[model samples]
Target: MTGVLAGALGLVVGLVIGTLGGGGGVLAVPALVYALGQDARTATTGSIVIVGIISAAGVLARLRGRTIDWRTGVGFGVVGVPTAWAGSLVNRAVPQPVLLLSFAALTLLIAVLMLVRGSSSARRTDGAGPSPGTPDGGSGVPAAGGGTSGATAVLEAPTRRRATVRRVAKIAGAGSVVGFLTGFLGVGGGFLVVPALTMLMGLSMPAAIGTSLLVLTFNSISSMGARIGHLDLDWAVIGPFAAVAVLGALGGKLVADRMSGAALNRAFAGLLVAVGLFVGVQSLLAL
Candidate 1:
């Protein structure tokens, strides 16, 4: 019975990660603790293993689709490595209830942000046509006979430069936060990664999902390395759990291909809220 439950939970976790490019860690940790009777620390350590493998599978599944932004994903991962290690150090010192509560709060906050971003994106899509610009929606170059002057061109160049710098800073900041959360909470941090890719880097939903998986894979590796000496391996549970999760991840990729970006965001947001609430309540009771 326990084995059956573990497989079912693992499938759910993989499906969430595969389809949404994140939230596997969020679901996996709780399932391990409550369903499989593991403690918080063990569950979190195991979550890193499960989420990492499945994320790698997800990245491969999307590779042929050409939806991943590898450059951005690699850059994000690079920035996150040190921070993830730091977060793991802190994770060992925190109490279980505090850790769980913190995870719940962060989860809820990200869900709200996702919903807001989704609504804003929908509004922009519905109410406005694409701006006059390059094929990729960049600002148009001034025509020779147009009323554009050298002075205006000079001013626009600096403005565009500053905007680019700001976007880069935002990406770096978001990556650090996601990495810290991944190590500290034993989560894939995809809930945050997808939004960062879409809102900051301007990737489409599919691209963001694929790239998010890559980022998760990197963060998971960094986090797991930090736990090498601290955690005891529970292969009995983690082994079978991860196997079924890989299969579910493949199925999830197919589901994601058919869904709209807005629908995916909405669904992801709803799931976060539900899980966050449950985790929050449970943590408070334990405290």
Candidate 2:
């Protein structure tokens, strides 16, 4: 019966990842600890495995379309990898109750960000421009250039797009925050990454989402790597959990195609907030 419930829950989490580009581990961690009776630390490690594998599965379709920004994604990831290892070390030292409480707080924060992003998404749908939480820093229209040769014009386009010192610093900071949370909490931080990509890196929504999956996979790998010998493998639960999630994610992509964006955002936001509240209260009471 426990396995059955876990399977069903994994399917729901998978659906979120398949359509939303992330959020599987948010639901997965709490479910593993409270619902299926696993240790919080162990659940965090398992979440890396579950969500990381599922994210890899989710990115394959996007890869075929050449929507991923490999340069930006890898650049962002390079900063994240080592920070993730550091976070795992911190996770190992934290008390279980404190960790759970922190996780609950993080979940609530994610809920708020989702609400902000959702409102922004709604506004964009109404012609407010790029998603709401992201303020367009300058005139979004590209600067015009004139040159005698077409080759020079083409060459200049990329040179103009080269990363400014400001851009590198911003990505490094963003990578640190997202990587720490991923290593400590077992989330991919797509909630943060998608907006960062769109707002900072100037990626479109589709491109941001696709690239986030790759970013998440690396974050998870880094987190999991730090826990190598200490990990207590739970194949019985993990195997079934991941298998169902993969299938659920596949179906979710199909369902996502037909869903209304605003409505989905609102609904998902509410669910996140409610779950966050529950986890917060429960963890607090246990302490």
At residue 270, give the lDDT of candidate 1.
94
Leading candidate by TM-score: 1
Model 2, span 1-287: residue lDDT tens? 76688788889988988776666787888889888899999898998899888888877766666657887788778899999889999998998888778877876776687678767766776884554554665533344553445666686787767747667887898888888888887766666676577667777656666788888888988988998978976888888898999888777667655666555455555666776788789888898
After superposition, candidate 2 runs with Cα above 4 Å error: 117-163, 259-268
What TM-score would you give candidate 2 relative to the actual structure? 0.81
Clash pairs for candidate 1: none
Best by lDDT: 1
What is the TM-score of each predicted model, taking all chains together? 0.91, 0.81
Report residue 240 deviation for candidate 2 (angstroms). Answer: 0.3
Error of 2 at 229 (Å): 1.4
